[model samples]
Target: MNNEEYVFAPDDFVLAGNDHDAFIDDTYFKQSYWKDMLSRFTKNKGAVVGLFVIFLIILMAIIGPGLNEYTYDFQTISHQNLAPRIELLEPLGIFDGSETMSTSTGMVEINKYVSEDGSLTGLEDTYYWFGTDVLGRDIFTRTWEGTRISLYIALVAVAVDMLFGMSYGLISGYFGGRVDMVMQRISEIINGIPTLVMVTLLIIVMKPGLGTITLALAIRGWIGMSRIARAQVLKLKEQEFILATKTLGAKDFFIIFKEILPNIFGQLIIMSMFSVPNAIFTEAFLAFVGLGVPQPLASLGSLISDAFKSFTTHPYMIIFPVIVLALIMLSFNLLADGMRDAFDPKMKEM
Candidate 1:
């Protein structure tokens, strides 16, 4: 047959690029999971603002104590229950033998000099910025100190929960059947009980202390995390990579740690992020019910409980700490939401 006649019209063989390797490597950079997650996170404006609010709260918590002259233990008998005073930086007039000394505001001379103690003053003094509590301690200082406590409790509790929960979940999920059934049944039993009631009972029996409170909260908090880890492990256990590792004579531990664990790390991180706020809230609730960190330590919930007595007169005491706590909780929730959306497999499908 002639070449032109035998050419199978225009639908014969299609010409394609032979740079498959280059395309695969190049496309990898564009489709990176972390890059996409970060991009999606940054696009969330509310999360960005929440992050800034959290940063500011943390900065204040760290620096506010140093800026104040009074210590958390400092108490002044004469200054007890005194409102903040405004100190003016005006020139003092010198009085001669028969001359009278007077203070002026701005070209206006005052006839009588009245020294008033414990009155509402403007923000010209260092005594109080936000105001004082019933104890006359600086609200600003106490609020920051409270913040440090709350953050510390939340972080520590989450860390402990993650350590125990992730390990339990990994083991249960990697080895199904008996291990999984026993662990999950136990989790269900724990989940069935009221978390608050268990915490209260522990507090009553063990006497509520920081360590006790943290331990109590961690007991129940880990269940959700374990369930999440278990689900992730179940999905990843049968993957091609995991099967390949098994075929290569890799040990179960090696396969679980090296292959399966890495695949579920993202989900674990997102779960941890969501878990932190819960821990903080749990601690706060304990404190509110008098089973939290003891007095003088100043957790947000403790501060709120204390402020409730003087709320009618000194609302700032409650308002300031509540605002700080709200900001922190909001920040964590926003971060969790962002992570959930970013790491969601269904999102990638869309």
Candidate 2:
């Protein structure tokens, strides 16, 4: 057939749509940057679960210590070493306030609420949900209080990292040349020292308490944040918008805080989130090693440390605190991973 005749009919000719309607119609709703980020975040089931768990833990930390009639420091020698017993679950024979004492005749389960005469002990009405430690202090109260302390330590670390670290990095990166070199060298020197050694030294020099722990964490924790901020600033300072701001004679401080900060804020937030678990774990470790907050005031690490002494005999003592601490670390890590993917969708795994 002739070429002209083949295209002659109107029905034979079709318009090139190129899926333009699909592109233009845009069935999805328009969302702001933050909304989009949050949408992405919520889509991650692991992250969502982690967030919920963390929120629950935080709430528990706030109120768990207050749930029982007994205060964290309340001590009763008679109630010492009592196993966990929930009044509601007592019939299930689980957490029934019984301790398996190793007698000459082998393991003997003794119901602490009852005496050898099968009569109800006067203290039968009293319950220790998480049981009592050697000192008879309620474990439930101490656990929550310890969690509260861990959260406080994490908050302090994040604050120091954001304020001092971010500021230091911004200045050093923005100034460049001799300023960057000197600042980086100083950071390197600080970073070179092992964190454990420094914290231990600080604990030795100062009273071992929240203040000393916070100070120890702040000393080198901020260095990592500074390095990250410096890298981001170095990459962004020469960008066209930044150069335009510089051309407008914007002050250094204004440009650094007002201009640069907003752009890298997401990354910084993700970094801060990651830093939380690290801070918490570090504080726990310090407490475990006996350098944490002094007795009476407990941290998770300290609780674990105390519980470890009788772990073989009373394993329940160590279980509760360890579970809480592990959950916190895992939850924070999962949340941070979600935030990272949300902020930078390009980082999402295939």
Candidate 3:
């Protein structure tokens, strides 16, 4: 063996026995599209953070009011224009309400006021956390109430839009030619009118309530979604699966809903995410203009509307509401962006 000599090829070299298959991990064989998407979504820090924040917001909307003693509309001039009492340094027992805060020259202290029974009464000097509004309604409670209202409008509006839009687009795109043309032309007519203008007119007729805002937005909101769905259907309808489904005598409804709908679902999801924020903003605007949910019922917009009048005297009035609204919109946007990237195979390639 020691005397054996190895020959070397001049032009090329070939390696002998190497087994590479043993190194592959179990994960290589245990992945799926959804898992891939979820993996990618988790990797996006902004999207994940935004989504967590959104969840927190929803939880806040659900449980926040119950945790607090104050009702959103329960007015008590005793607490009006009170600054928030968060006591950020209170946790370690620093500024906790156990000790009286210094009622210095410029600061306000809890006051005593007469009750409706014509008797003098004193209020509990509790934390106002988010302070009080002009009418002395708890701003924190009202903000949550407004969140509930705005969320209601947004979800209902988006649902209406999705339902109507998906059906309209499926029918129109599945059956092209005259039917498509007629449907598209009709949509164009509806789209020609400014959505806000139409909604404004409708609000005038309906006189501003949850139903009115939902109806007004739904009346026109479906058009945009329908157009998006229609375009996607047109593209996918010409694909091989659709062609095979048509050849197999699948009913038109079956072809459209079953064969075509699932493939384009990702887009619908992303679009819906976007629509939620838009609907929330729209409702807030309407409320700001005095066309939102009626009086006594609070919405974020209505809160802002009320805040504007006391801007100089009470800047905190606007600050809290604006922060809540901005957070909601930003969260939705970031979540949608992440969802789009996660769900799109093309994005995965990039």
Candidate 4:
């Protein structure tokens, strides 16, 4: 009814220049799988902190032993059981080279700088950041050296086990039927034996050193990885892409490694991360039981074992190594959890 004053003017409409280009430019960019996984991983605060802590520990493990003048095995009976002292932190009353002893008058705090006669011992300038062990060796230096050994053992064991597991699982799953059956039975038999028992037997048979420990771990370590890889292969083998690859006459090896492995590699990597902590803990346990690396070559477990006897008198002896071991285990677990969440598509949805 009021159409008399309304008229469409050409000036009211503006030409939209480069609207297609704008749409194209504003479209979301596609990211690669690893890039997406990394983006998700970085979003986890706990995981990021764990990664940073692990990096710091690794850096310290590499350089910490050399920071102080004293070698790990350097002994001085006069310096035995000296409390942790640092020149920088002493002014704050902590790490002031003090030790508490149970005397006839109950507990008495004594300055490391003072001798039995209560006079200056002339060692005020001396510092042992983690004090000294019963053998008068530097605990700080030994701790780092021990960390290095523990890490080495864990990494090497895990690497060896992963290689075996991945290969076994791929072959077993790829060639199903009798091949799968035989492989599964063999793995089951190996897995039936308790890991501790295997390790013990190996220690009894061979020398209880790094190689023995590594071999013992490898014996049963691959079972879990093999199972995981097998399951993944089973699941993926029936997928359309795999069927297509097979139809295309791809070689079995090519199909397994190139087509299938790349698909399941992320899961395998996650499993490997989970296995690291177990390997580390196992090595530490063996070391604690007097089956670890021999003398002059310390591991975190051996260090803890050495400190256990004097723990009642010098609690510091055990504290440092235990703390380091705990941190390493915790950080790896957190990082593994983060990786699992990041790489898993189902978790991404959650």
Candidate 5:
């Protein structure tokens, strides 16, 4: 058959013209990348649970200590080393246990009474929920307080690291040639030095305090983040969007910060999430080894160290703090994993 004779009818299939307005209208109603990411994150049970746990920890750290009248400064020589008070649940009795007889105004009475020995004489005995530390301070209270320190240090250190690392990485990555080579070499030299040795040297020279410790950690911690960010920028800088921006004569700063940085922000956020746990661990270790925050301000590591001597008798002190620390670390790690999955381009490809 001739080609002309075999032509198909226009009605065989409908044609949808490329209506830019229709496409624009559809896109206007579509969910953004952040919204989709949020939906995906919400569906991740582990991440949701981790976020809940972290929120609870933060809430406890912020509010729990305030519930107590003793502000870690309430002291009594008489109460030192005193065991936690144990109160028993009394069995229900007939007549609602009302044994009130008289009062100063007229004649009022109550079933509960204080003993001459000062023990809770009217109630039955119960176990201490968290027991007590070596100094007889409530382990439960101290644990929450210590949690605040841990989370605070982690957050501050991560912030400092990110600020320095991101700036250095972006500048080096965008500039590439000599600047990149110099910065990368410097990073390598710093990374070559043992982290512990550098930390120890700083502690010795700077006189150990929370600020000094944080600063020391920030120095070593930024290297890995910088390298990761630089690598990301190198790959992203060659993309079409970046090239277009350059072609339009956009300023270097504008292209780097406005275009490139925003695109790689997910990776930066994931890296920061991972960095927090590391900073917390580093602070804890430094404190444990006497190179951490100063005295009177109790960190989990410091509390654990203090409880070491009486660990046999007051194991609760160490146990409680360790549990809190572990929970914080675990939650951070889970959150990091979630972020990694959320940000991973490979997953999107799949």
Candidate 6:
């Protein structure tokens, strides 16, 4: 065609210099709600640090027990009531060669039971890094071991909530009639009794141990999750997509599990996060009251209970467990808060 004949018409579509199409809008990233939520969550410095702390605690719980030479139950009166000592710190002049810790009562040292001549009376091979209990069990090993048990209980409790509780509420609320009323009534009956009283009764009947503690926590644990799930399902079931799926002949189970469950995962997960710390605390309390794991099988609460006798003399025993429990509970709280902010649109707006 001649150049003059090829003159652009008024309605001719003109191309930019580049041939590639720019179909994606420049504002797409800005409009992404999920991406912006994540950015906002990461900006919360406390949450990020809390996440890191949790990772370290988990790592310690997994690997720390094995690294120490002493077993959690290993005990000897010969080396009883030793104090925390870092050999490396000795070289730095921060700690002397002796295992001595400054306490509110007085300066406490390792009770090696030396004679007046200054010779080792206890077994020479064993070393207590974080000190020892009255029974001479290694505190460092016991601490990590207790951490393992506590984390395990929390994990199992959270799983019970997410699995059974989530399913129960989904089924009940989706059905929305007799099933809902019956299921909700059951949950309410369980909720009617105080957790402490029910757990106490269960403990007496079932025999107090790790298994009993886990069972009690799980039995009551799902109540919160079920309530949350029911509310979420109540809202979700009213949406147009859910109505459309029902009209399309989707089975109740399929609709609830496949469609509804995935949509409410964020809320469910947030509930699970909050549940973990609560479960951990309950286990600790049960153990403290002598209804948790039996003797020789250390847990954070049991360790604290054991220390109660000589707590004034050997406060480190109480202090260490308290610190670990505090760390775990606080970390989960921060993580839950972060996740809520990251997943909830309303929080992202703030």
Best lDDT goes to which candidate?
2
- The regions of model 1 sitting more than 4 angstroms off are 1-31, 80-126, 204-207, 345-350
* lDDT of prediction 3: 0.80
What's the true lDDT of residue 281 in model 4?
Answer: 92
Q: Give the TM-score of each candidate.
A: 0.77, 0.89, 0.82, 0.89, 0.77, 0.86
Error of 6 at 216 (Å): 0.8
- What would the per-residue lDDT of candidate 2 be over residues 1-350, giving only the tens digit for each residue? 65674446777878777865555546775668889999999999888988999999999999999898888788999888888988998889888788787767899888777788877778778888888899989999999999999889878888988999989998999999999999999999998998789878897798879888898888888988998899999999999999999899999999999999999988888888889999999999989988899989999999999999989788789999999999999998999899999999775563
Worst 10 residues of 4 by lDDT: 19-28
Please, what are the lDDT tens digits per residue for candidate 1 over residues 270-313?
77877878788877887887877776677888889888887754
What residue runs in model 6 are displaced by over 4 Å at the alpha carbon? Answer: 1-38, 93-126, 347-350
Backbone steric clashes in candidate 5, count: 7
All candidates' lDDT scores?
Answer: 0.73, 0.89, 0.80, 0.87, 0.73, 0.82
**What does the lDDT come to for candidate 5?**
0.73
Q: Model 5: which residue pairs collide?
A: 88-124, 88-125, 100-109, 100-110, 101-109, 102-108, 103-108
1 or 6, greater by lDDT: 6
Cα error, candidate 3, residue 266 (Å)? 1.1
Off by over 4 Å in 5: 1-30, 73-129, 345-350
Which residue pairs collide in model 1, if any?
none
Error of 1 at 215 (Å): 1.1
Winner of 1 and 2 under lDDT? 2
